[model samples]
Target: MAAKSATKSVEQGRNLRPFYANHTPEQLKEALRRMWLVRRFEEMAEESYIRGLTHGTMHLSIGQEASAVGICLELTDKDYITSTHRGHGHCIGKGAEVKYMFAEFFGKEEGYCRGRGGSMHIADPATGNLGANGIVGGGLPLATGAALAIKKRGSKDVAVCFFGDGANNEGAFHESLNIAAVWKLPVIYVCENNQYGMSVSTERSTAVKDVATRAAAYNMPGVIVDGNSIADVNEAMTAAMERARNGEGPTLIECKTYRTRGHSRSDRNRYRSKEEIESWKGKDPIPAFEDELMALGILTQADVEGVRAGVEKDIQDGFDFATKGTNPEPSSLLRGVYTTGDAA
Candidate 1:
């Protein structure tokens, strides 16, 4: 009789290596950790909203972690990024402090906007995060202007604008792209194609199969990437960044991803079918990347768990900081609105 094996089957466990093979060990570890943080942070924001801890409407990026992290990884700290309303992932990727983000949502003194602009308006100018906008297609022009500034200053810095598929349908998208292309501005237009613009799917919204295809109109190269694959997204982003820095002008990258959560906290997401949501959920980026990394021998079960734990701790610390921080003074609220007073 043959003896039965005692070891656990690899099939029973997670494997996430291939997507991380191009990454150094530290980069792979940080990637895993950042994804975990983004997920956890979204959950926290959702919970806070439900508990009435956060003010204003909340938009959670539950399944769009890869697109944010992968693209932002290609940018330097000095580079700028304009984000959309559902931009927690982008804010985090661009190195915004989780604590300040939490404070921003809580409307506390420690918030990025000094308790003025809630979830959708989070920004850290010091980190080159211009701001996340409430209006669709609003940030596009701002990004173009920033690129112009970089050009005028003769700086190697680039500006990346993150927007939804809905924004592409706007005139600002077209106008900004045209001007940026004509001027050869250093900018990257990243369309986080979550297949939905609010409640409308891309099929119902746009006639084009790929949003990147529109880049051709402006004489720029447009590329489509599997937003679900962090590795591919990162590679595409790196190429785009290189093109921008070399003064070759902007590249339009449409990352085909899906958002599992509703458009906002009030949304029931009844517009989409359950089967559709399930289908997209199956292609979720985190687990998909885990499988790829394990295959490439870059991650093991323990590694994933450790990274998750670290993220949890950071999230908890952020919450603690937000809660412990003092609220801003009522009179001080009027300050910094228009001008800074001179001490003299």
Candidate 2:
């Protein structure tokens, strides 16, 4: 299997096409920029938390940039997405502005959630990001429902659900997939298997060797891709989106990836070895993608450096916006707590 994969890689390199053949150079560059943004946003979020600028805990997707950007590359603002707790990347990939995201993190009223929902719950309706859930496997049913709604409305739009490996064992995962398959719902289930679920390794928790294999029971296509490779992820998502648009039910995609950071702010890095972390860092999605682009002559070193510089400015600007933004008023605490008007 390893030899076959090597051979395929060699062939792909020889044939090298832009991630999506039709994608323009600018679009490809934008994808790279988004990946960098996701990484930088998380880094800044962590720095802010350490500096006592933010109070609540947050999950970071620093090493998993390719999975988020690649999956969303094929989706438009009209398409929907349900994100997990570690969804900063998803928000950025779906086109949420970093300034608003930073504001939300800083608990400013100018946030996407009016400063109520912090890192784990940012939602932008304009971008079709239904919301990021704090509960485990929370987005599964939500995406399923969104896909059902799309079907009922007779629309070609599909809903993508991003969940972690831990969520795979949740009842919602099985229930949602079953219903989506039975009704031919246009939902794509993306499992970002970052090796460990919080601290527990999948080898110890999951019965199946690969999470995608579980989709077979639902009679849908199950695909596994190297989540570190943006092109690999984009190709898989493109196919899944195509299938969904063709009225061909839901598809399950498992991104074999790793997260370089600890699960949350409180984690002490006790469970995993330093060697494992270092190994994954070597496969860091941003540099890997940049290398691919350079190899293909899609971008020069100066172009890559320019993108990084632009991202640095964006991150700094977002930080400034968040810090200068107004805080949520204590007087309006109950504003969005309860639905006003006729409850009936």
Candidate 3:
């Protein structure tokens, strides 16, 4: 384990170079396919919301696929992940069945949380997904507790907590990082810094130019990456995961990305400019990965189109299954909230 540090510059100087690991052509192809699927799923879900099919507001992960997929690919079945409100990308990357995720969004009984938890609270314990949290910074402590559990169980499993840059402003964020760092818990804190926490920009709230720099106070590795580049995202994630798996400690990774949509269901997003949005859009993860694959002669225009078609069909099937499923019974509303009669 690394010695604890109390200074910011030390942390910054430690891992100035981004981590990179070679991926086979097959693996790269699969990543591109999954990224495409996630983006399509987000678009379809948004359409459902606009069509009055979904009941609640949504937090889309449309433009931030790389960060979610990159970090999640490094996790194992025993390793846990706590997701954010914008959780679809993470859930997909963690291998949660897309059909069930869409079902949950549509409030079906077959959903991940049986339709009770809805979009924001979809969880699958079988896959080690703790669930997506609705409250800002809510999953920070939950993930920390999960890391503590891993320690008690004497396992090598690490907890990956995904949150936005805005979440760093929350007190729970700081508290959890402090505790995890102090105890040397196996947790990787991924801040998907989409530049904005809702409509509020990070610059408006934080004194630090980069959120990763804050990791110094806790004496952990902090890495910043180009969130739009899936390659860069995966490279950084590999290093952080390796560190945690080795019992070294937690890491704070800031992925600088942007969301193509508004803050929530209703925001018009008058705060941000079109030029900024377009600038980030040019760096979209899917296209970047596609370009790389094509450059390596791995993917052609036809292959890309085929992947898009398959993803569309898969998403449509999910929506169909969800809409056809029945809603939950009123009596079952209180289900899973409390433990039933089974004393130890």
Q: After superposition, how far is residue 2 of candidate 1 from its true place, in Å?
A: 53
> Candidate 2, 115: how far from true, in Å?
0.6
TM-score of each: 0.92, 0.94, 0.91
Per-model clash counts, in order, read: 11, 0, 0
| Higher-ranked by TM-score: 1 or 2 | 2
lDDT, model 2: 0.90
Q: Order the candidates by TM-score, highest first — what do you get?
A: 2, 1, 3
Worst 10 residues of 3 by lDDT: 1-10
Residue pairs clashing in model 2 are: none
Could you tell me which 10 consecutive residues in candidate 2 have the lowest summed lDDT? Answer: 1-10
Instruction: Give candidate 1 regions above 4 Å deviation.
Output: 1-22, 342-344
lDDT of 2 at 100: 97
Tens-place lDDT per residue, model 2, 87-123, is 9999999999999999999999989998999998999
When 1 and 3 are scored with TM-score, the better candidate is 1
* Residue range 1-344, candidate 3, lDDT tens digits: 11112332112433333322244444555667788878988888899898988988888888899988878766777889999889989888887778898889888889998888888898888889999999989999999999999988988888999998988999998999999999889999999999988878989988899999999989998899999888788788778877887888899999999999888888898989999988888888888878766765656888877777888888888888888888888877667767784221
| Candidates sorted by lDDT, best first | 2, 1, 3
Q: Which of the numbered candidates is closest to the native, going by highest TM-score?
A: 2
